[model samples]
Target chain A: MTVTASVSTVSSPECGAGRPDGEYILIPAFNEAGKIGEVIAGLSACGYTRVVVVDDGSRDDTAGRARRAGAVVLRHPINCGVGAATATGLAYLSNVGAVAAATFDADGQHDPRDLAAVFAPIYDDGADVVIGSRMLNPEGMPRVRRIAQRLASWSTFLLFGQWSTDSQSGLKAFSRRAIGTIQLKTNRYEVCSEIIAEIRRRKLVMREVPVRAIYTAYSLSKGQGFTVGLKTLARLFIDRILHW
Target chain B: MHPIQWIMLVFAAIAEIAVVAGFRRGKIAAKGIFFWTVLWLLVGLVAVWPDSTYIFARWAGITRGADLVLYLGFLAVFFLLFRHTLRMEKIERDLAALVRVLALRDAPEQTNQPRADGDK
Candidate 1:
């Protein structure tokens, strides 16, 4: 399917005044057609006027749905993985001169209300990166997920020499400097760890904010399973060796 | 010569002929042709004269010529596999970069414009 560049503007008079200037919400979605529209609508309800969704060559109508829901949709020609999608979103944001940007999941797991807390450190404290930590408010979070997150955090710390409370959090904010400074090479879930490593390498200030994770059956199913987690770790190790 | 030696010699001759054919078809460069030619010639010589392998094996401090050949063959396979892996990774990275460029170039002109539904 040929997806041409099209932007659908969502004009909400009531929420217009609350829109944050020069700040965009970047969502990397793959086959999230069932929930992508609602995710975009939720952002619209939250007074966020700038939303960019990178459809990572989904087999469904995710790109069309996102465009119709008032998001600037960037469609990959092939499935390049979530990391590639995020990098594409960031590159587009940088090209458009976004001052700050937040990466949010399209699976409807992340709350739009937490956007403020995620962007707070970037705008107020001059933080280069702000991570929305689910561990800070783990209420309703699955025990298995929590343990997996802890293991990932420890792995990130050991490999990158940078400790993050939630290393794999999808909800994170990046200032313009952070967006430009951090170079992402991984094309999968491993990009999360690569970002943390970039934070240490580039001397970027990072802060973690308390954010609630709304985990539904759908969201839980969409998350990385045990096998996927192992693959990600293996890829991370291979990447390290290859680049080293 | 032993039956195994005769088999080895025939295989080496076939490989040499294939290499020459590849070079004639312009699929192999001059340097590649030279390298493969030398390699196959060495293989044919060792197969015809089994004692030649022992002399090299003794120089390399390997007791058996067959053992030395086995070690060298394993090393060559590993080196080729490593090179292939690196090339594949480079291709992956390049493909991703191309995809990103295409996505960005095809992006809407006004990315930050407000939508009619109050979304950007």
Candidate 2:
């Protein structure tokens, strides 16, 4: 891909040449002190120096670890769920004039190597929103998670008439325009479907990129169980009715 | 009408009148107050003539008028509870958002602070 000169002007020269202007990698963390530092370091090594970590009320030293690893840490006084953390990070990025932002999971499940591919479309201004879809390859993804994600994707399609292979993927990249226009209200996992709804509602161009999710015992344990999935479904239904 | 039924009817009538009077003095919307007053008066009439419920229930394919009222009441209560839960969720989300803003705004940049439990 040919690097656009305008895009080159906005990226940090120290990280990688031609990185999007005001681009930042956002990680919303909760009690992942053990993994937060590695997540930040991985991004930095990828030539993406602009990193922001929203420590979602972790009782551990997640905030301190992230800061030490060269990340701008934003702390939430209490756990506000992943959705709220992502929103806080996005709000901060927008305030700081970020041209694009990518949200990465802090559970050590995501690969930092995919950051460049995820942000490529946004950097080239080819898409307004890019979602990382594990279903594209489904390698290393647990069977339960794969099933849950498919069900969630089907439900999201039913609600928003837009479908993605992985609607529940924790990784997504948003252009500056998408960040400024898409306002998220749901503060939990339901916010993932809400984003799809917003993309449909605002008619924003969305692209799904094939990405690998390395689901280990720790990451698998942190996923939404059956009960949480039910609650999420209920909330989404209520929100849909209210919007109607 | 039976004596007991008459007493119940009179009590319901009085209660409706009081409610209407309170609505007039309260800040409730005029349209809502009027609707409630009319509903209460109708309810009073039904209470006085319990037999009417049987007729209505039969028309609605229910076994008894009392059963119809019970089912409707349950439905109303469930609807109200659902709405209340939604409202409460909204308030909680708003509070979280406020707290998040405050936290971010007051984020500590001091990296030299000693870890109370290092590598524990």
Candidate 3:
């Protein structure tokens, strides 16, 4: 895909009213009705209007809640995975002529204030991909979750030969070229690592920035527990072995 | 021949014939029928010559012929189970993709809830 110079050449719009210069916020959610509305409201208050939510086959009224929140909802009829949902969101953003895209978790863990910091590099043409790293400022992060996130970072380094402080962070900002070109194959949580692998393979310029995480009991429950984290790691390793 | 040996031979012959008939009737694939027929013929051979299993077991470093056959059978069963599980996961993934595509295509153009952000 030939990325025209027009992609990064577009300037970021001042946060006043309408959709800002093709910068979109994508939320990949599954059964996150309880928090999705509040998250969207926060982003809307911050003047980020181009929000797209991929409802990942939730049994609940997640799509309804997201639509109510004024987000363009893309439904997945069955629960695919976070990876698939994110891919779907990105595909839609690219289709809608977005110059840059930012992915935020739907579980209310991400601070909406940090969306600008994550997407700034892409908006300014300073980086192709900006990863919001929790490791940089892990205040209020649980110890067990911190350890698992570290292990994920280390594993990503070992597998993809590129190391970042946090590899599984849900908050990521992508340039139009990155969002349009990166091919995602995995349909599960392993897509987090796959994104890193894609960045490495394509030799895209990547930067990591500090971002605050809101770790309430509710958000903590949505995170990968010990067993789930282990399973995710095993699946990622198997995917690497399979060259997927 | 011993009564048990005769019984084994008759059963194996029946099984082999049944597999061939299944293939002819299009109830089983050619490869599956061939595998079952060979398995049944092997059973008949073992029954006719009980010493053959002992020779095979010795080659495999197994002291008991029955133990060796049991181990091999367990291995085959486990492998088949593993394949079945993997196939099931693939099907589930495919089904999820289908559902996602349908949802994206068929969902209402206008949401029931009012547009919260207000951008067209």
Candidate 4:
């Protein structure tokens, strides 16, 4: 199967034949009281028919707001990591027989337009997994995210010998293979890095597509603290070195 | 060797085991594991001690083992909430950033609440 050239459109198949990759937009949110509504509406408008918001125990109104935005809501009742939330979302989609599942951030850095890029390869059966990369356009990407992406890329290089441009992009599309093989266990932001590590370890058919990224003051404020970066390092240690 | 003391010992043992089980089962996360493991050890220690709860209560200036029992059960709920609060804070921060990104892009707000910080 040939990889789709780009994520240019959000058009659906004329019919859902033999479970033709039912599209589910999975939003795993923690607090996200500010951005979830528009995310749900945007994906819905952008042609995502089923949107599932997993509220990872936000003390705020993340779940309530998500429900208001026409998404099916699942609350964690306490804070689990984004990894856990994403795992929950994947589990649900798999259980219900979703053919294709796209994970979009509740925090709003992703362009729904890029969904096609992330999923097109998987949608066309060319790759089992698709990752979005801001690294493709370095000048267009912001400085802080560039730093994070580099860290993600290099760590993945060290782990799997697979050099990914942006291993940590929140936007990813999965084929049934991804949903089944990549077992996600981390509950924090580090899970983004962990997913790529798993992909490299498993040697899954993976591709990175250039996608547009949006960075705003709010996202910057929420960007990982040094401790989060440290946590990512710690996970690398635990997973690769310590063998814990 | 009285029947009541033996009964109390069995009850305490069961309670301590339950606390350990909760930790093992991950009815709580890491914090849960650490807290309950320490607690279960303490309960087990007290259960095997020569002194009874009545004597400890009178001498130690505390109540019966009921307090200890209640503490173990309630700890799980509280810790779950603590982790939840921290998770909420982080998510709120991420959402705020994402919202600003979308808002700047001129996308519509999806929440019933106003555009500014909701629920702090």
Candidate 5:
């Protein structure tokens, strides 16, 4: 497939020459045709060009839109969960010899401006993984979401034995070592907590940066509901018992 | 024999016949046929002699044969469910790996190249 060109210019100073050469932004999307293009465009507008979108068997034109928005699109033939998509993206990045990689949500909840901040610790501070925490400055976050995020963080700490301000955050940067070392087995939303477990087991240096979340109605609707959260918790518990 | 014992015996006989038929038709492997045959034989034995379980129940310090059977049934169900879940998870992981490999193979040739728009 031919890669399209972004019309916007790189205006962010963070996207200038000092940016690492082999850094890539990985976006895991499932039926996100409406928002994937805009997310890619936003990243492109911020001058973050090395974007890879793993289309998780989207029935809509998600892959097409991402390709049109100037992203390297990787299409899964079947509908695997976000965890599988992220793992696929990481494998690709590792195979391509990427220096660093950051995962961005295709639902447009994450801000493109925060990409630099997320990657800062990886490059500047030598962190293996940098998580962009919305809880750090959750000024405008909805009450229910805030509570849910806190509960998820607590559960992740209890189950995986790692504490984070936002354990389920989609915005995370990984260094090359982290990318090659971390192997994901879980294929669902539970992968977020599994990543925390990996951080502890692999002894990877992890840091959290405060990042703003753009919580539109659509974005909010796309997030995990009560049933999904319960299922995620159950699967995480099963994974812990079986694997750990 | 009690009416319930008669019904269970008939059901076990029918199941055993089905298992034999499956084995004859080559639909079931030798190991699977052996397992099912043995399981059905045990079921028939229990159906024929419900009081036989009471001896084992007493040996295990259980009060009632029915209670022992119920407990064993629950254990069997749970064990099968756990095995099924593990098998399903392995299949999912295998499928995900296959999909990932296919996606990687089909990725764009210009994956690492700078976009033509000079954004990089």
Candidate 6:
């Protein structure tokens, strides 16, 4: 697990020392004020400090709650969608000098306790990007979500020849280089599918790590159901094929 | 000419006349050079009077004089649109630069962590 020091000189002393392992946590949220504080607290307790919580035009005080929870907050004036929020977070990471950034859910479905599970490969194991796969250990998975996940995963695999254990999981990590390439034009939920498709098309080194998924009634209701799933698939096709 | 076509022609002529007058007066952003360009474009659609000439022409065919005037009018409109597109491009560039800077400012500082993926 020895990383070459080729990039050390390019990084400033602050960047080199503060994040020698090249890691940061990026959380994009939309009106999750009720849940963001707890999520941030959990991550902070686990020593995950670099939390970038993007408030996607929440009428409520999602940003304020995240700030109070010690997570740095970014706000979108209007709801641009999850894709734009993630892009804003990544831009922030690159802007303020982070080596890499990971996207985690704000709905409390994902555990901040497992921060290293997704980040370790990119930081220590020399992988370009890593995905946190709940399907690898889908003990708490609901039937509806499982079906939706399977459809999304299959379509991506069929279209882009990119197959992973979990395609719809929001928990994922990205090296700086990977984020740079993800700067294409996507401003909504379709962007996650777009990222997977792009990652496969570029053949960037990616691996999936088995992780726990908490699917309480709250988190399950927060997810898109059948109709939205159909719409998401349609959008993914247009973006990956027609629009690519 | 139909009343609208007549009005458009009158407006276009006034605008074109204003441009000439401005050139003579040596005015750049004056009530002529730029504004006339805009006015010409706005009223340019009038020159395409597809039904106007048919209804108003002597032989139900486009008159040579009217046709020539309409051609020039459209040319003026297109030229203005091109100029405006260039201006819009400049504004878009500035906007993109500003957005990139604002998005990147105040990024969270990074440090080592125990990950949430539950990985070693």
Q: How well is each residue in A1-244 modelled by candidate 3, as lDDT tens digits?
A: 2211112212223344454567788899999988899999988887777678889989999999888888888888778888888877777666666788899999989887777777777756568888888888888888988989999999988987777788999999999888888877678887888888888888787877788899998988886778878888887776676575
Per-residue CA lDDT of candidate 4, range A1-244, in tens?
2222233233322322122336777888888988988877677666664677878779999988987777767666567567777877776666666667788888887777777667777866567777777777555666766886787678866764566677777888888777777876556776787777677666677776777777777766664666787777666655565332
Which candidate gets the maximum TM-score versus the true structure?
5
Off by over 4 Å in 2: A1-21, B1-49, B107-120
Cα lDDT tens digits for candidate 5, A28-93: 999999998888877877778888889999999999888888788899999989999999999999
lDDT of 2 by residue, A166-216 (tens): 889888889888888888888899989988888887778787777888877
Where is model 6 chain B poorest over a 10-residue stretch in terms of lDDT? Answer: B111-120
DockQ of 1: 0.44
Residue-level lDDT of model 6, residues A1-244, one tens digit each, is: 1222111111101111233444678888888888988888777666676577888778898988888776677766667667777877777766665677788898889876555667667766676667788777778788777877888889877766677667777888888777766664466666667677767656667777777788877788775777877877776675555444
Q: Which stretches of candidate 4 lie over 4 Å from their true place?
A: A1-21, B1-120
Model 1: CA > 4 A from native: A1-17, B16-46, B49-72, B114-120
- Worst ten-residue run, lDDT, model 3 chain A? A1-10
Residue A217 lDDT in model 5? 92
lDDT of 6 by residue, B2-120 (tens): 67777777878887887877778787555557766765765565454544444445453556646745766699889888677556645643554444345455333433442332322
TM-score of each: 0.84, 0.79, 0.82, 0.62, 0.89, 0.64
| Higher-scoring candidate on lDDT, 2 or 5 | 5
User: For model 6, how many clashes?
Assistant: 9
- Measured against the true two-chain complex, the DockQ scores of the candidates, in the order shown, are 0.44, 0.23, 0.32, 0.02, 0.49, 0.07
Sorted into a CAPRI-style docking class, model 1 comes out as acceptable
lDDT of 5 by residue, B2-65 (tens): 9999998999899989999998999989998988888788788899998899998999899998
**Per-residue accuracy of model 3 over B13-105 as CA lDDT, tens digit each:** 998888888899999898888778888988999889988899999999999998987898899899788677666657866776676667567
lDDT (10s digit) by residue, model 1, range B4-117: 989989999999999999999999899989988988888889889878889889999999998988898899789889878777878887899999999988988855554626
The CAPRI class of candidate 3 is acceptable
Q: Is candidate 5 or candidate 6 better by TM-score?
A: 5
Interface RMSD after interface superposition, each candidate? 2.0, 7.5, 4.8, 13.9, 2.3, 6.2
lDDT of 3: 0.79
TM-score of predicted structure 6: 0.64
Candidate 5, superposed: residue stretches over 4 Å from native = A1-18, B20-35, B60-62, B114-120
What is the per-residue lDDT of model 1 for residues A104-160, given as tens digits with 9 covering 90 to 100? Answer: 999999988888777777777778888888887788999999999999999988888
